[model samples]
Target: MGSVTTKKHQNGLDYVEVSTDLCQARIFLQGAQIDQFTPTGKAPLLWVSAADDYQVGNGIRGGIPVCWPWFGMSGNGGFPQHGFARTRLWSLDSINMHDEIVDLIFSLKLTEQDRQYWPHDTEVKVLFTLSDTLSVSIVNKNNANYPVSLTQALHTYLPINDIHQLSATGFDGSKYIEFGEGPYQQPNDKVNFDKETDRVYTDLSPVQHLHTPTGIIEVSRENSQSAVLWNPWIEKSTRLSRFKADDYLTMVCLEAANVLDDKVTLSPGETHTLTTHIRWV
Candidate 1:
């Protein structure tokens, strides 16, 4: 019913290949990043940039980039932005094939080298359940005696027919922190990209729908308290590495995150899982 394979991807990165009657997917061992997923009888749902070179140790412009330990710049002046998970290679722990679905477990442990940034004993893993729909479960377990506080995000880039015409419905009356700064606004209409849009929203809405000319796409999550709506527009889009300046017109990111006031605190022996589910209609 399903199969798993391995292949050498861009710049010598290794990725696990999954194939089933219901869908096809590719998960890079580096950062456990998923670059592609297409369910049967549906249009391609995920988005990747045309300028992506897939260079080793560099985060691809699109796909699900797991930002862990910290989401944005931690202001340390020494740590890498979006943590080191996206640059480090993850170990594939297990893979199981069922009647019509496939499950793959990938693990990453905090190493001595990683301690210099935010020293904490931790274990991170993501379970990818791929079938007609895609579900990614990111689990963080704290091993340190003291409580560890951190922020993480599943940077999910979604494909749409057009960015200008796309409408995201769900946060009709919610407030958002624009560009990580203050003066959060409560939009009167659904999300529509007029220009550079980067906002972090709280209130923990459970479901969001991205409406395109073709159809409406559903994004659902569990155990997530924050969502990031982003489209680099012109200025930041041109500055982005491995991304075309005009690529934002075809893609938008609605990420599941726990940041700022929603930052997660995990005590010793405690674990937290943030999950995101995507489907197209």
Candidate 2:
């Protein structure tokens, strides 16, 4: 059996803490983000920055940040990077416990200020299932009469013993576009981190395996054809907010995304759900 309780973090953010027979987790109301998840006897499957201040307006540097409405820069200089969803507070709508599993639903309130960035009648919510494995789903419903476009990602930061010793699979034949680089094909079967890497992969396999020194992590996605693999490495880490310069050595992001050509355009009254499941194998 599991129990859910609310506690205020030292940073003044409110979060739901779950302790179950199978696992323990924390879900922050802000961003509806899961910053800590660890199966009862296993190592942590997620990572957070030690330098994060956990402020109200600033996005947390690690865990899972919901990048909604848009991903990355919106091209409009005035718009915030990676949209505004990660900075807004979400309401915990429901909590259901099934034996050792706990399901939490969080709904975001769209305000008049949000319409200035995206003018559409839309409803967004996130469902997190905590058990032996962690599963998350972001549901977007178009409430408008007209169509709406959306690009989003579950920006997941994974822990690693060392970035230099990590290798990932599931993008062998996928087409990837690096930041300010070509749409190149991944020639190698395994991806190794050495330098700064920022890649948006399309036509990718739904499942990916991260071989870390600690163990293997299996990441699978549903209703998503694109993914982003990023690491600030050395130089960029120094400039990243709420992140330590050496943080890149122990963390890597393997985001399940809907970006580039995989972006979604929802018809009126349509709903789209993006889900990702992560587990230690």
Instruction: Tell me the tens digit of each residue's lDDT in model 2 across 59-173.
Output: 7899999999899999987998899999999999999999789999999988889989988899999999999999999899999999999899999999988999999998878
Off by over 4 Å in 2: none
Deviation (Å) of 151 in candidate 1? 0.2
Scored by lDDT, model 1 comes in at 0.88
TM-score of each: 0.96, 0.98
Q: For residues 1-281, what per-residue lDDT tens digits would candidate 1 score against the true structure? A: 67899999757989998888999899998899999999988887799998999988798888899998799898789889999998888999998888889999999866778878867888889999998889998898988899998899999999987898999988866678885586465666477778999888887587899999887889888888788989999889889888898898899999989887888899999999999999896
TM-score of 2: 0.98
Highest TM-score among the candidates is held by which one?
Answer: 2
State model 2's lDDT: 0.94
Highest-lDDT candidate? 2
